[model samples]
Target: MANMQWTLLLLIWMGQCCVIDCQLYEFHYINKEKTWTEAQQYCREKHTDLVTVTNMKDIKRLINISPGNWRGAWIGLYGQTDGTRKWHWSLPGVEFNESEKNWNTGEPNDKTGWQNCGIIWKNLKWGDLSCHDHQYFLCYDDKYILINKNKTWEDALIYCRDHHHDLVTITNMDQQRAVQQEAQFASTDYVWMGLSYACTLDLWFWVSDEVVRYKNWALDGPMDDCDMSGAMETKGNHQWCKKDDTEKFNFICST
Candidate 1:
């Protein structure tokens, strides 16, 4: 590694002994210094990988983990070496969007030399820099939490965003069981989840961008409508229920 500078960036592995589904992605800040490539390898071996910036919300989280003012770190995005200058997220399955550019004014410029790697700037914007330039970088981890107070789906979402992360997403039985343990203490019959129905698309989706691979719907099946959102029973099988978005209930948040 060359020109490595110090900043906190590292991924601490999660609880393996627990029965709960703690697959919620988390950003870790390690103080260790390394080159961009070294940082990427370290993250992949220690946790998931370098951070992926999906939206402004992710940017805000990245900024929160930042060590100090004017300091920056490597993100998952990088430029093509073929001179196409095409940008791509390092995490597979995440597609780069033309509309998602948060480049600071007149950036990705070659004036700084053959800039190829993407680093998040202190201004909360992305810019191109040398991959060989060592710096502290962010790696991601995962976890979840339960909020016992009752509130509407929208309100619950706001609370989770304000206090923790977004609403929890359960894509498998491991996660379902883990979250269900928290649900048992809910004040309401059902707990607000991140699931929602898109009427135009006519499908249920997780608000956290997780694909609905696994399901635990009630016997009657999911109710699909614009006003419908997902919840989990606090009792019985803890199957998912389709409820109106206006309904109030306890909720889960990822940490």
Candidate 2:
């Protein structure tokens, strides 16, 4: 009886260690010289896409890798002068949903035959603009911080509690939008969200103890994983994806 009890305890302990979740991304810098197209191909074959700089955080990261001299490098940004108007978000996961767009009247005319990027006007309407045009851009600052280190969900939660507040809690669309904006700076396709399922209760809840009343689950909905936790896609629609807690990933913590 004593031996059986000890074995059961050991199993439980192991299980606990296996269910850690995380959210965040990693980056690598290549010093090789190449044009934008070449660099894109190289990054795809060797690493991920050529560093997609979406926010100041990404810019700072790039600056840190500077050669300390007046040397230039190629990034993933380019202009399509072929009169092809393909709308894409400067940020990754927040894809341009045609069904959810608000374009200005007769806008996106590609008036100068060089509008490839997009912007939201003062009226909260979107417009296709010149990719080369230098203009003021909107930046969102959520109270959450992205941790670049890889850790399990449990480990990430503890780190957030010890360092910042706790893992982030998204209660509404506004909060979700804030998180999605923040995620654009992530190095990973998905970042951890403070959501989890309790097998004992057979219910989902946020780590911040907020009721799971609001959700932005992925099109497929949350996957079944009693030992899994929630993460947000950093590339498309910023929907939540269920992943095993044991999977190591970069994470976000609330401030």
Winner by TM-score: 1
Off by over 4 Å in 1: 1-23, 142-255
> Model 2 scores what on Cα lDDT?
0.60
Go through the candidates in order and give each one's C-alpha lDDT. Answer: 0.76, 0.60
Name the best candidate (by lDDT): 1
Residues 1-255, candidate 1: write the lDDT tens digits: 334332333222233423233334456765567778888899889876788776676567457656454377788888886756688888665678989889888888856676888888787788888888877687775366678787999999999999887899876665786588678778899999999998999988898776787899999999676899999999999999999999889998876
Q: Estimate, for each residue in 1-255, the C-alpha lDDT of model 2 and write its tens digit.
A: 111100000011111223112112334444443444454555566544543434434345434543333133333433344455454443345554556545679876778776655554444344665555443332222356788878889999999999988888877664676677777677777888789989888888998776887788888887666898999888878889899999887788876
